[model samples]
Target chain A: MPENMTHVPYYPGCTLKSKALGYERSAMDCARSLGFEMHEIEKWNCCGASFPLTKDNLMGLTAPTNILIETEQHCKERDIDAKLITLCSFCYNTLKRTDFAFREEPGKLKTLNEFLNREYKGNVTVIHYLEYLRDVIGFDNLSKMVKTDLSHLRVAPYYGCLLLKPQKELGLDDPEEPVILHDFLDALGCQVIDFPGQVDCCGAYLIMRNPDKVLELSHNILEEASEYGAQTIVTACPLCQSNLDQSEAVRGEMPILYFTQLLAVALGLETEQHQFESHCIDPKSLISSCKKFKEFSDAK
Target chain B: MQINTENNQAAIRDLEIATGETISDCYQCGKCTAGCPASMDPSPSLLIHLLKLGLFTKAVNSASIWDCMACLTCSERCPKNVSPAAIIEGLKRIHLNNMEPEINLNSLGQEFLAHSTQQAVVSGFRKFV
Candidate 1:
C-alpha cells in the first residue's frame, strides 16, 4: 500500500484555488511527504456547488462534466489509472453526483455530451480527499509517515452536509454517524471529539444573504464543539471551513483547521505558516501550541 | 391559505416533473421539518403541504424555500422519501422562471456581487436560475 501512489490526479475545485489555498497547499505537501505526488488536472473549471436537482437542467451539468471529460482525457493520454480526488466536499458531491447521473441516466449523458460536441464515456471516478486518505492511502501508512504525533490536540471532525447525504447512493460513509474522519484523526494521533453538530449544515451559500442565520448555525456548531472541550474544529469542505471560521459570533475563541492542515502539522511538512492569515479565527496560536510542535522543534 | 388548485395545476405538474419526487405522498408526518437544520417559520413540511394542496404561488414566495440550505437531511430522514430540499429547489426554479425576463444580469451591481465568494454566487444562481 505504501508504494501504491507515485503520481495521482487531483481536482482543485474553484474554492480551493481561490479561498481555500491553504487546504490545497497543505494536502499536496502532505501527499508528497507520504511518498505521493498530486498532479492537478492541466485545465479545470469550477464544479458549481449548486448541483442542478431538476431533470432538465443540462446547463448546470456542463462545468462539472467538462472537468470530468478533461480529467478523463488527461488520464487516458497518460495511461494513468487514478481516481480524480477532490479537496472541496462541495466539489466532491457535485462531481460525484454528476458522474452518478451519467451512469444512471445514459440518455441524459449522451444528450449533454452531444450538445457539448464531445463524447465522454464517464471514465473518471471522483473522490473526496478524506476518502483518498482512508481507502487509497491507507491509515497504516499515514501513521507511519507522521513525523510529529498530535495526540495532545482535541479536534471536532465536522462532515458538514454534502459529504454524506442522499445516503442511499453516494457511496460516502454513513450519513447519520460517519466515523471515517474520526478514524483518520485517531490514526494521525489526535484525540477526536464527537459532537452532535458534526454533521449539521453550516448553511452553505446562505452566508451572503442570510448572514444572521449562517452565524446562528455556526454559533450552534462552535458552541457544541466548545462544550465538548475541542480546542479546534477540523473540516473537509472549504465553504464549511470559511463559514465556520469567518463567523463573528465565535469571536476568535475557536480555531477552525482544515483536516489537511493538521496532516501537514503531523507530518512536519515545511509549509508557509502564513497560509492561515486569512482565517478569521486564527489557528496559528492553537496549532503552534500542540504537542507535535514541541516534538517538531526538538527534532529541528 | 386559499387553495387555487385549478389555476396552479400546471405549476404543480411542473414541480413533480422537475423534482421527480412524489409531493402528494407526504402525509404531514413533519419529519422533514423536524430534521431540517435551517428550518424556520413556514417550515419544510408546510412548504410541501402547499405544493400537495396546489398552492404554488404561496409555496413559491415562501421564505422557508430560501431558508432551506439544501442539506438533504430531510430527504434522507423522510419516511415516504419526500425530498423537501428538492421540492424547495423546484419552487425556487419556478420563481426564477416566472421572473426570467426581469432577471437582468447587469442589474446585479458589481460591487454588491463582489462581496460573495464564488461558492455563493455559483450555488445561488445555479439553484435559483
Candidate 2:
C-alpha cells in the first residue's frame, strides 16, 4: 500500500460527495497513499436504504442490484480486475451484501439479473474501505504507513446495526462485538474504549419512520460513550457518523466523528479535512480533545 | 426481554396506533420501552407501550423523537418483537413530517438525511435514486 497505484472503481455515496465531503477528500488522500485509485460508479443510484422493506420486497432489492450489475458488467466489459469501493456505511452494506448474496444465491441473482438487464448492466465487487484495509491490505501493513500517533485519545468504536445484527443473514461481522473499527483505530495509535452498546442500532431506518426511537437510541449512545470515557466516537460509514453527530438530542453535547476524520488527522491532513465545525455535532472541541498536538514534530 | 409492564404509569390502549402495530399482544412486556434511552427523564417502557397503544397523543409531537438515539436494542431483545421502538419510529416519522415550526433539528437527523441522500444518489435507494 504505497502512494502510487492504478485506478480502481469507487462509489461516492451522497454524503461523501456533499455533506461528508471531508470523508471524500481524506479517502482520496488515503487511496492515493495506499497505491489505489477510486473510479466512481458513474450514474449509480440508491442502495435500498432509508426503507429496505418497501411495499414490495423485490422492488427494494432492485436499487442495490442495479449498481451491482453495472459494476459486474464494467468488470467484464472492460475486462478490468479492480472492484468497487464505498465510503458510505449503508451503501457498502447494500453493495457488498447484494453482490455477495447474488453470487451465492443463484435463484435470487437470476431474478435480479432479469431486472438488471432491463436497466443497468455491469460486473462489480463491492466493499467498504475498512474491509479492503483489513482483509486485503492488512492493518499491520497499514499501521506502518502512519506518521502521526493518536494513542492519547480513547475512541468508542460504534458499528451501529447494519454491520452486525441478524448476523446469520448480513454476514458483515460478529453479532455481539465487531472490532474492525477498533483495529484500525488501534493501528493509528489510539486507545479503544470497550463499550457495551458498540454494535447496537442507531435507529438508522427507524429515524425517518420514527423519530422518537432515533432520539432514544441516539441519546443513549452518547451517555454510554461519555460514561465509558471515550473522548470521541469514530466510524467508517457516514450515516452513523452523521446520526451520532447531527441529531439534536445527541448532537452539540457528545463528541463523535467518522473513522476517516480520525485517519485524516493521522495522514497529517489539515483540520479542514475533518470538517469539525460543519458537522451537526460540532466536534471542534472533541477534535482538539483527541490529545492536543502542538505539532507532529513535538511527538518526535 | 419480557417484563412486568402492567400497573405502570401509562395504559397501552389509551394511545393511538401510530405504527399501525397491535400492542394488546404486548403482554405488558417492557422490553422495547425499557431498552429506550431517549430521555434523561424517566419516561420509560410502559409509558412508551401506552404511547404505542394510542395512550399518549402528545408523545410524537413532543421533543421525544429528537431525544431518541435510534438504537434498536429493545427490538432485538423482545420475545415477540413488540417493537415499541418500531412504533416509536413510526410516531417520529409522523412528527418529523409535521414537526413544530420552532423545532430545533438535531445533528444526527441532518447527518442521516444528508447521508441518505448520498446513498440514494449512489444506488437510487431512497430519494430520486
Residue-by-residue lDDT tens digits, candidate 1, B1-129: 122335687878877888888889899999888888886679999988887887888887676676778888988899997887888888777667655421345665797566456677678666544
- Candidate 1: which docking quality band? medium
**Candidate 2 CAPRI category:** incorrect
TM-score of model number 1, chain B = 0.77
- What stretches of model 1 exceed 4 Å from their correct place? A1-5, A248-250, A291-299, B1-6, B100-115
Q: Which candidate gets the maximum TM-score versus the true structure?
A: 1
**Per-residue lDDT over A110-184 for candidate 1, one digit per residue giving the tens place of the 0 to 100 score:** 998999998778888888878888887899878877777688888999999889987665787999899989988
Q: How many residue pairs collide in each prediction?
A: 0, 58
TM-score of each: 0.92, 0.68
DockQ of 1: 0.64
Query: What tens digits encode model 2's per-residue C-alpha lDDT throughout B26-48?
Result: 66666656555444232436545
Which candidate leads in lDDT?
1
Task: Please list the C-alpha lDDT of all candidates, in the order they appear.
Answer: 0.81, 0.61
DockQ of each: 0.64, 0.14
